[model samples]
Target: MKKRLIVGISGASGAPIAVELLKALRDTGIESHLIISHGGACTIRQETSLSVEEVQALADKVYAQVDIGAGPASGTWESLGMAIVPCSMKTVAGIWSGYSDNLMLRAADVTLKERKKLVLVARETPMSPIHLRNLQELSMMGAVIMPPVISYYHHPQSPEDITRHLVGKILDQFQIDLPQFCRWEGEPHV
Candidate 1:
């Protein structure tokens, strides 16, 4: 059976990361259920040429932000796991605090409560102690706090290259095989 992935996009600045992740999932022929928060939609408009509809079209399935009744909101939904690419601090706090006011948070909460992998691509800088504490709490709860930090070892030369590099790393957490952006031999490049 095809693995099901629930992809959440929040109001974080790195909307391209979310888009690239979705595209990579599509390339791999995985079924992606997407949920974009209101702020996420605005960021997409600011960051990419693709319209909101175009971005939503990339997903195999789409759920509204307020639709807490969606299938992914329950552990019985039988999905591989959920990822919140470009996860905002607000959404992170919601997930950490068990605030299921929206579909994104609800899905993430379900993933954690069900002991399923919930990868959070936290996209914030100059984080306060509060943010750090929340991340720590989530980590303790079995959520993968994957920040969108790029590796310079890849020698990425463009924005797209950086985005792909990070997305590849995210897929790694899911154990979803994809071509490596840059291979590491644990030694200096020949």
Candidate 2:
């Protein structure tokens, strides 16, 4: 099978990041297997002009989030890893506890079991103590808990630019490069 990356879209504020990530994956010729949770579908409608179907089109394959038997739910499916963009706290808790109630969570669980990369763009502000603890445990378990925190050093001019930069950073965890991703250079000599 071609190189594959599982992309999970959960309900969170940064839906645009997920959209851009899909577009980037398409541009790089990576086969993207997408799974959008019910909350994710709602977030797409609320946050972006594109419908969930439109976003799904960017991926090479789309799986229903409710389908727990989906290809990504099994370790045998084989993939570079899984990325949950705009991951909600609920989804994080689900994965941290191995509560594979849906395909997205199940895929994450499988990724951890297979010792594959599981990058979570956790999108929440002022994370509660519970959130921090869960995230800490997940990090200890080897999942990359990358919240969508902005980097001013990149000098992002617009929201899209920020989103792309964040997506690039997430892809970096998988060793995938986004051509437009700007790397930070140290201060210029006086």
Candidate 3:
């Protein structure tokens, strides 16, 4: 059977990461179940030409952010793992505190409790003490708190290239490595 992954898009600055990840997931034939927050929806609108409905259309299934009773909100629902691409601090705090205020957080909470892979692509740059502490708390609890740090060695020529790298790293947390990303050898690719 095809692998299923839960994708949560928070209202973080890096909307491209989610877009590329979804595209990659589709290319790989990995079933994606998506949940997006209000902020995430706004970010998608602000950052991309794709409408919120268009983004949602990329996924095999989409869950309303407010639906805490969604299938993904329960641990019994099987999945390879879940990733919050461009994870916002609000989402981070919610997951860190086990504060399932919405479907995204609730699903992430369930992912952690079920010992499934839970990757958070935290997007804030100037992280405050609260952010750091929350990240630490989440990391300690076994979530992969990955920041969208770009690797310059690849010498990416375009935004899409960088997005591919970020998407690759995000998917890597779930052991889903796509060949579209550049892998650093002993030296940088020129």
Per-candidate local distance difference test: 0.91, 0.93, 0.90
Q: What would the per-residue lDDT of candidate 3 be over residues 1-190, giving only the tens digit for each residue? A: 2399999999999887898889899999899999989999999999999999999999999989888898898878888989998899999999988888889999999999998889999989799999999999889999998998878888899988888888888787778889866777695378
Q: Which ten residues in a row have the lowest lDDT in candidate 3?
A: 180-189
- Top lDDT hit: 2
TM-score of decoy 3: 0.95
Better of 2 and 3 by lDDT: 2
So what's the TM-score on candidate 1?
0.96
- In the predicted model 3, the residue pairs found to clash are none
Q: Model 1, 32-57: lDDT tens per residue?
A: 99999999999999999999899999
RMSD value for candidate 3:
1.9
Q: Over 4 Å off in model 1, which ranges?
A: 188-190
Candidate order by TM-score, decreasing, is 2, 1, 3
Q: For model 3, what is the error of residue 46's alpha carbon versus the real structure, in angstroms, after optimal superposition? A: 0.6
